[model samples]
Target: MTDFSVLAQTAKAWPFELARALEKRVAEQVKAGERTAEAPVIFETGYGPSGLPHIGTFGEVVRTTMVRHAFEVLTAGKYATRLICVSDDMDGMRKVPDTVPNPKSLEQYLQMPLTVVPDPFGTHTSYGAHMNSRLCAFLDQFGFKYEFLSATDCYKSGRFDAMLRRAAEKYQAIMDVMLPTLGEERRATYSPFLPISPSTGRVLYVPMKHVDAAKGEVTFTDEDGRDVTLPVTGGAVKMQWKPDFGMRWAALGVDFEMFGKDHQANAPVYSKIARILGHRPPEQYVYELFLDEKGEKISKTKGNGISVEQWLAYAPDESLALYQFQKPRVAKKLHFDVIPKAVDEYLTFLEKFPKEEPAAQIENPVWHIHSGAPPAADVPVSFALLMNLVAVANPTDTSQLWGFIQRYAPGTTPATHPLLDELAGYAMRYYRDFVLPAKTYRAPTEHERGAMAELSARLKTFDDAPTSDNLQTLTFSVGTDHGFENLRDWFKALYEVLLGQSQGPRFGSFAALYGQSETAALIDEALARG
Candidate 1:
């Protein structure tokens, strides 16, 4: 038998928000005093399959999986853990996503369950299946461990039939939980189960004419005035969003789930519905939504934000994971501009993690991002600095970049420093895409030229392999003597003249990474202003 007492204490000291939630959930389960210790803990994440999965989908699953891993550690083999990625594929198609083709044709399928609509891309059996495949591909890209569940399959297979009957048996109770959330007009006629039109094959939201819960059936008149009745068990009807949420909890026995902050209003209704069905609601955590550069919530339908494919083009998956590992509740802007900084920050965390104490290690972001064993901290240079070097050096290949890296960090190779090598490529791509096109180099002033000359002369005093500390001291002295108010302006001027960029990585580190002799020549090149 595993004793989680010590693990529980350790979890309390952990600083991550997700970890803290896991600790609380675990402690609650232990306190419940009725459940068996060996029962599997169900951790779930939800996806709306109305459109292609975006980067936000990636963030949700990855974050939840991180918490699942932490829970496993806390339990220490006392309980099994299962992560299920549930897709709301049974939801009606509200709008055609810009990413999909044939918009005009898809308009006819509006209000139909995505599971019954044809795949516009001709990829899979149904639109929902196509989107589910895309989500699986995206998850597989990151090697995520999860079991995929389709709402359509769950409803059709009788797995959720019992819950559906329960929802109908307590239809009035379910409506009570949702009516308070709706406007006056919508409250006049609302049913928890939306029956599918047998003739038109579309989701019909009309008021249920009669619900025979004992027979597990719902009858409704279609818009065409045709009487339709079907058993609620076999995909003939699907529960509405609020009640469906709780039904899913009771059916799957989900221990934990997370959602966006926008859903905070509907959470209580879901909890109430779960209780009406005689099951406790799953533990829930709300994370802030990702906003576009304009500070509006990113929309999957409008394609207003960057896609997962777009992010992977210019940054590593680990960098994206690092971004998700930050405080989950704080809203952050997501755009191409954030990639370089995130990549550099990831490297910094990797470099610092090995030196931290054992207790401090658990709190480090890299520890959670890597899920315990972080990669070796072999990167001696930052991604920002590498981008700067890529811009100035204009290397035709990675060897030139590796040449500079090998000089200061000797004997490191691509195999030894995979992340650094991969980041070098991303840095170059980012420089070409975002940095190089907009850069305009301003000629240094006469005084600045004199400072550069003095800086070049001082660098000649040190041999080819000067220490970074010595290089920093000399660089600072040049800034002080040049009458610059702050050292930041000094570095900006140097970057403007040398790299044609207004800002760059730490000047001392850059100077030492490039040999002392090469650095002096670069200053001379900047001073010549040719």
Candidate 2:
């Protein structure tokens, strides 16, 4: 098997189950003498243009993409694959966004079929097109390679007519299912695909036929889990919904589709509609909802949600991709703190994995880290040290850091490499603690300058030794010269010279690691400046 195939098979535990089910379905169809081996298989996802697409929206694309990738690996180029991102742009404006400059009085018609939403930006012909275009660009930028299709364009084509006629003929069986599913259904039937207008905060009234048709006959109310219907000026099949689903399937030639769990009923509705349209219904599944960091379900109206733009602001796109690949059935709770950690973790994974043949990808974290701890073979140093290194990094040059790594880490590295950069970052914390906290011995007085001169001269003998013990020896020598005066005071002055501060970490030890020549030169410069 190819690398991609092996990695993919290991990653997908349920592939055999899915493959078996698919084979059985195909065999049954073949036995009926109705199936073909050359038919195109599609992975389709319809996006809503109501607002900026969120991470959850991207999750669908990622999962569907994985499925496509899996099948391609299985077929080894025998089956042609395509992932279609259908933008339901023709949908009407149901809720106005606060970002738009001026939202007209389009609410009454907003929740109607997506084909009717008005473009509030006045940028596109309709709201559906406007939202669809943005979503297409977003999906493309997200590394999803898919063809974009629009509902309005689909309706313009005659692809839906056959499906519609079939639905019209099988309309009674659909009603049989709908009446039982809805319970207490009365005078008229309903289609699951009709755009529902959530006017009056909840009621989904049937939209009037044509702006000129004058009056809508169907009135629907949710009673005890049933869609109770009553007589109105314009009710009947005109108020049904399958027409839209049937039309969409043919227009796009979609093979598989998935929706959120909230629409569990809609799938069956679409399936029956597909049968009525004389076409195969797209294979379907439901996605669970996402939660906040604290583990509560996300709601668009509640405004307690994280946007994709906010996530990408801090995360590399690949980390976001990993989160998407994480189990579709599992709900993830995420927060801001995850950003820095994700960056660190991603780098670690790359370091360990190092190679990617389509089949050998690291699809799960457990394979790397077992029982809450990473494998014992690859240990890492402290994050604090890395952060310190990064903070103190000089953009114009990095020879000094490279020299230190050669002395200590023993490897080729980037100047701004994550670990190195973090190590240098220590200087920032040092400044806050010492440079900003001095109250006495602020600068070297004349006598102190003489003492500093004497100390610097004596330190020349040990210029090559920056180790802690050597620094301690030099400190003892300097301590003997200031018997009556505060020996600590002179030491602070020395620190001011070396690190531009009155006090810092134990001077001798710090001077050693920072290098004897570098420390000596800094002391003289700070003395000259003040």
| lDDT agreement with native, every candidate | 0.83, 0.53
lDDT of 1: 0.83
Model 2 bad stretches (over 4 Å): 1-33, 105-118, 183-253, 276-281, 355-530
How many Å off is the CA of 226 in candidate 1?
A: 2.4
User: How does residue 389 of candidate 2 score in lDDT?
Assistant: 30
Cα lDDT tens digits for candidate 1, 1-530: 33433444455322244555655666676689635666688899999888777788998898888787777665555678899999999998988877678878888999999988899999899899999998899899899999999999999999998888888898888877788888998887788889888888898888888999899888889878987789989898998888899999989988888889989988988889888987778778888998899999988656787888888989888889888878788999888888888888888888888898756666677877877779888777888888988887788888789998888788888888887888888888888889999898888888788888899998888664576778888899999998989888888898989888888877888888887888899988777764
Clashes of each: 0, 44
CA displacement after TM-score superposition, residue 423 of candidate 1 (Å): 1.1
What's the TM-score of every candidate structure?
0.94, 0.61
Write model 2 residue lDDT over 305-379, tens digit each, in one string. Answer: 567776665445555655554555677766654544555565566555535443334344423222112232221
Top candidate by lDDT? 1
> For model 1, how many clashes?
0
TM-score between candidate 2 and the true structure: 0.61
